[model samples]
Target: MKEDIENTSDSLKETRNVFIGAKVTPTQKEHIKSLAGQCGMTVSDYILSRAYNFKPKARLTKEEAALLQNLDDCRSDLVKYISALHGMSTKQRMVMFN
Candidate 1:
């Protein structure tokens, strides 16, 4: 019995040490619970996967997909603008700063 107790104490020490708490609305709690269930994971596991960028084959909703596309488009436009500026001669570039 003493050996079993010692083993249990050692096991507990090997487990995670961090704790986090958040105050979420009931709706938010339900949403997170549902998502965790869909992934066959506990809420902690689901949150950990997301927080660590684990890419668990999660699917984005249509709105999220659209927003991501818009962000990509904006990035592409910025790249093109920067490239255009980079290709200009120094005098031509300086003209715009005046």
Candidate 2:
């Protein structure tokens, strides 16, 4: 999806003069806008992504992304640490985790 975003922007950045208009009820417009907002996309982006068969994911805040990366690093470290505890029983491992 990230790659798709970059590619789409690169391909269309200087050539986005064509308009693709559609008629919808005011209620429908609001609903579409709400859906776009929920995914951190503009209405046009939400529509384009959907049209291109890409599943939209919620955009993350910078802080949230950093925290997730940190958590992943910690989990990797924990796996390495656990492997070094070769004498520990499986039961001990489970109990310790709990």
Q: TM-score per candidate, in order? A: 0.42, 0.48
Estimate, for each residue in 1-98, the C-alpha lDDT of model 2 and write its tens digit. Answer: 97886698798876657789999999999999988987999999899888877888877778999999999999999998978666689888788789
Number of clashing residue pairs in every model?
0, 0
On a 0 to 1 TM-score scale, where does candidate 2 land against the true structure? Answer: 0.48
Worst 10 residues of 1 by lDDT: 52-61
| Clash-forming residue pairs, model 2 | none
lDDT of 1: 0.83
* Top-TM-score candidate index: 2
Q: Where's the lowest-lDDT run of ten residues in candidate 2?
A: 9-18
Cα lDDT of model 1 by residue, 1-98, tens digit: 75675588678886656799889999999999988876678899898777756756556767988999999999999999999999999999999888
| TM-score result, candidate 1 | 0.42
Q: Model 1, which residues run further than 4 Å from truth? A: 1-57
Q: Each prediction's Cα lDDT score?
A: 0.83, 0.87
